[model samples]
Target chain A: MIQAVLTAEARTPGAARLHAALMELKYEFIRLMRTRAYSLSVLGFPLMFYLLFGIGQRSSAAAQYVIAGYSCFGLGSACLFGIGLGIAFERAQGWLELKWASPMPRLVYLAAKMAASATFALIVMGLLIGLGVTAGRAHVSLAQAAELAGILLVGSIPFTALGLLVALIAPPKAAAGIINLVYIPVSFASGFWMPMRMLPHWLQAAAPALPTYHLGRLALGVFGLASGKHALEHWLVLASCSVLMFAAAWITFVRSEAKSP
Target chain B: MSATAPAIPAAAPPAPLARLREVTKRYGQLAALDRFSLTLRRGEVTALLGPNGAGKTTAVRLLLGLTRPDAGAAEVLGRDPRSSAARTAIGAMLQVANAPDTLSVREQIELFRSYYPRPLATAELLNRTGLAALERQRFGTLSGGQKQRVLFALAICGDPEVVFLDEPTVGLDIQTRRQVWSEVRALAAAGKAVLLTTHYLEEADALAHRIVLIERGRVVRAGTPHEIKHSIAARRIRCRTRLTAAVLRELPTVTGVEADRDGVVIFAHEPEQVLREMLPLDETIGDLEVSAASLEDAFLALTHTS
Candidate 1:
């Protein structure tokens, strides 16, 4: 259904129309980068998490675990932080109507927004990799480092899609609360904040249900830790979750744009 | 009726470029546009005029396809606004200039220009909107009027076939406002349809080929400015006369009369004939003044009465 809608928007939509949508996307991207909220959340929380968990701890094993956890959790937050919240705010403040009135292709607008958010997610991954290897003393092989980068890049999809979906349904100010409600508790439940071995059996059983949990387990694998024989299952779960979130977000976004004033 | 009348067959009046057929947007129980219907044509400017809750914004929103009419259809360029094909023909400048504050005005225009496939030159946009010198200034640092010009620049960047401007001159100085008015006129002259919503009566009266007066979510009157001004048909006559109250009341055309320090003002349907009758009775009508009905007065009478 989503593909059909996008395809229809593209059928003979002139270069000028798609260009207009891309321009709106570029503006949205640059605007998000310059905002204090985006800068602080993107760069600040990861730094704070690194300090409180990795450096502040005494044990090397604890520090290593913290490195893995903070890298996964912080990158997840970064993916959703600005794009979702910013979109919600734009909707609340009535900027969406301006876009609706322009000679811009609506699908291209969403496509560009997703692209911008993915770019920011890449920046967050780079921050995590630099901080994890340098200051946190997490030793890594070359293959593992590459895998970790790949994990951050691939793992960003679900959250980015989720952020778009949340922005679709939530009000601007409420987006932060909604994202936190989804991210923090899910991170804790998924054993990203603590080792799954140390978690209760019920939590261990339910962790795989979350996209973030699968992502964290995958990250643990990059750190040379065993994510169990069901690691393939985790991969499938994350892929399916990402697809589902993308579909949901796309549907909600279209409906919201259709109804917006 | 000349034989050489261009053999044009009088090209039947162009179909309305836009029309709202019984459109209504309801937020729960509040009707933003209560069964509103309006028409706009190519190369013509139609002003949407109303007070705060009179549904002017709602009508604009519906026409832009930002909000769907709960009951009716809003057709722009002969297509639903929600459709991309329909939207390509539109250029709009809503209330706020919500571009990134960090981007320079030039960057902002360039960015917006990229959204359209064939955009106007950035320099031309800046010059047309009167932002030539301020092009390199950051968006946040620009004054409100300057930002508005940039927004206008963005609106016209694509050179759309139809333009919707909602209060485009709200914060502008007189000179800036005049410039925007000329731009609006120029757009129409170039054969683009223009729809504007303004609180300024003069803007509607001066720029719009037709004015749509909305009150409480319904269009109470829609016609040329002349027709709208004459909608109420209440012309005023002021005379500094010593005519007795009985004499003024005796005139059948005088609908109402009240005394001011300088004179007795009369509101009559036929002010010219009524004042002529009173001329012989009061030679001391030194400060006498007569003015035809105005759009402002017409608006007050229409909206305030109903």
Candidate 2:
């Protein structure tokens, strides 16, 4: 009986509907790819950071640390940039209302958005990893590289959720300001540009509460470059954040739909 | 088969396409719709007519299940508008101006088409809307009228049983507006029910089988165009006499008088009676004329709020 209900629901979405939803998602990604802001967020900063800290003739140990840290930073950048900024622009232009009026299922629309966001995050991570393997000349084993990729993927989840939360809370006109406020502080506090140990005690204490901090720490651990006892704790924090963000976004979606005229 | 045989095997009687029973929508201190009741029959064209803020758009939103009424019931195609089945049966075009800039006209059409179970042929719709030449052009690059045409295409692309067009041609030129009118008329001819709200009184006069005129959240008048016109007093009379605006305003039959660039428009109930009165004041008046009451006059007369 459970299977029958699920199938009945699933069967309602015909091939055309799925194709349409995916096409909308593809259109969204392609449009973002053309915008200067998305370009800067994904490629500009990561490349500059990689060159400034990960690639130069600075201290070898410092460079390796920068490499791992910036890789995680790249993942976070993709999430906040792709999901956060994209939704704000859509809301500002009344596109979300149009979508709501259409026959497109809410799940389908959100699933497409999440898929596109993940794809962009993966691309940014790949570029950073390529730089690490080729120019950084890091001694990461094949297992370590696989583990790092897996960790980066997991790290993307919480940031994406956070981006969705921002999309719900902020109006489109104020989206850029709100996102800047969110991304800057979160990025700095996570110690992406510096090591957590170097920060003050209070900041270090607060680092575990942030998704980006946990993700960065997880990336460093996977590269076999750090010695930290709280890996499990950080992992738990990221998992909990992902769940919360998803829940908040779901509530926002339902509320917005109920509002009319 | 006999000529009277039912086209599709008749089962149970299908419900009324849309029904609103004393529906009222209030926002804060403002009432957008007050006890507005309307029933749209299946496969019929019902035109919603009024000035801005007359609650026409509000009523459309209520029928689309976008807005909940403060009181009374609203249903579409036998289900509450918020229900899945009702949404599936209805399509709408609102007055929002922006679409995503990167999507080409073809892409936009194709995308909307995917959202419905049954869709019209894209090529045919494009040709009908005169957008075939600009198929590959991005939506944002098109002129305002072209964009509106694309929206019209999207609204009907679903081939929904009931379609709502709210001020679909707000800024289109004469030619484009007529083109949209034809498309709407064609939809009605094809057995699709349409609920249209438009500012162009002539558009309603030309297309709507039944008209509902709203004012300040209430249906002040509802009937056919002829009925509405007949409800108001007959022929309008005006003369470009030296009658001062204040003096003209005193006449009981003169409902309104306003200055235009060329001359003043004196709205009066009896053209012959008012014309006879004006002749003594301006015997040399070259602009004296009597004309039949138009839909615009009827609208002004019925919907004039203090």
Candidate 3:
């Protein structure tokens, strides 16, 4: 029995690879759950912001807008801080080196992080939707709610790529602070806390350039709460940003490896 | 030949499990490994002994394919170390590594085991490493010794044919150090090739089948423990005597002397000659002790001159 268990052919290569990927996902999930401060902030901050600003509004439309805005804010924070700061800290700790030495595929490592961020995005969306329905007096059908949830979850990808770029470029010690600096400014400018029309003219014009702006627009468009002009263009811009950031991340990763051992 | 003569097949020596042939690795102006070479074979334990910055870690990194060598070749299981096939056949415990803090010991082991196509049973691994009782404890909460043992367990979880342990017991209490040493010995006894690196001379002498002493990116000496001890041809003589260190240094075979609380300790090339001369010079000499030089003494002598 031991001999059979020790043989290399005991399991198919494909099955073993899948098992390894799942294990990475499981462990990453466990790590995120155990870090109470990070989890609470990523999941709670946006909900708190929504409750404070959206709850007392007499206008249901205003409440709906705040819901859409903060949903983008919540998911963006999850991807940016979760992937960005997490990777930087792991590299500093030499955990990345250990993982590279193991037989675990590099893609699986990144995929696991992305999956965990997406899970958090779903949780934040669920909580925001619940608060919007009960306290904010927003009316939405089940289909619309599911569609908005899907959009927000999918919108997290671009931010995850951006986070990876930050992780690869910044020094680990300064990564968290730098990410926070970037997160707040970008979220505000992108109208994730308010509507783009309320900002300065120049800031409103530049809103479309930020991926968060495009993501929030898409979220609002799902409920017919905002203009749907060039919805495809919004997706195109976000997708293009994702592609560019991913390429930059890959380049930075290769360069760092060459610079080190 | 007569038909009744029995045919005898010629025996062949098995290939080395891992080899570094004239490998050279450099960082900026400093050469971490300069034209270094070593081989590891099945069921053999080879210890790379060196002081800090002696390039022992560099050599292990090159062999594990974590870093590429500048000049020559390194192979594991007769294939380039970078190949997945070669990597699958080996396991390594690096000098600087820690598992995820939130995961329990068993979870960590299970995760690592899933990476390999064939892995040892988790129960057996925990039992062998004496980690069964601490199976559910968080990795971050474990003591330093327990953490090292967990790393050891991960290194062997894959049932690797060759294992690399880079300074496995650098900082540990004596009892914990001994526990890790015995586990390493057990790995070799199971017919696996083991390569260990450490600056602790006693560790190398106690656990290694062959010791290779490295200094400044080159192997200064390589031999068995007995051969290394005899190579120096130095002996130490300690006795409670009235002679001062200055008088003892003047003896023919005595090269150095130091006065201690016990008496005077004499370092001599020939202990017998020193002994012959000592008794005649002092009538009150008593409680004499003569012993061969230890590996530590040999290590210092070799590294200091080169």
**RMSD for each of the candidates:** 5.5, 5.1, 4.4
Best by DockQ: 3
Q: In what order do the candidates fall by lDDT, top score first?
A: 3, 2, 1
The DockQ-derived docking category for candidate 1 is: acceptable
Q: What residue pairs are clashing in model 1?
A: A15-B117, A16-B116, A16-B117, A16-B118, A17-B117, A19-B114, A19-B115, A19-B116, A20-B115, A20-B116
Interface Cα root-mean-square deviation for all models: 4.9, 4.1, 2.1
Q: Please, what is the TM-score per model? A: 0.82, 0.85, 0.88
DockQ of candidate 2, scored on C-alphas against the true complex (2 decimals): 0.39
Query: How far out, in Å, is residue B77 in model 2?
Result: 1.5
Clashing pairs in 3: none
Please give the C-alpha DockQ score of model 3. 0.50
Of models 1 and 3, which has the larger lDDT? 3
Which of the numbered candidates is closest to the native, going by highest lDDT? Answer: 3
TM-score winner = 3
lDDT (Cα, tens digit) per residue for candidate 1, span A114-144: 6666666566556655666677665555776
Q: Candidate 3's residue-wise lDDT over B1-306, tens digit each?
A: 698897666654334899889988888788888899998978878999888888888888788888888899999988888888887888888765556688899999988898888889999999988899999999999988888888889889999988999889967789889889898898888888899988788888999888888899999989888788766747888889988788888888876676768787787889898788888999999888888889987787678742
Tens digit of lDDT per residue, candidate 3, span A1-261?
433333334677776677777778878878887877679899989888987888887877787788788888888878877888888878888777766777777689888898888888888878887888997877767887788888877787898899899999999889878988988999999888888788999998887778888888888887777775678888898899999999999999877765564
lDDT of 2 by residue, A107-214 (tens): 776666666766676676667667766887555567766787778776767877888888887887787787777777777788878877888899989977777877
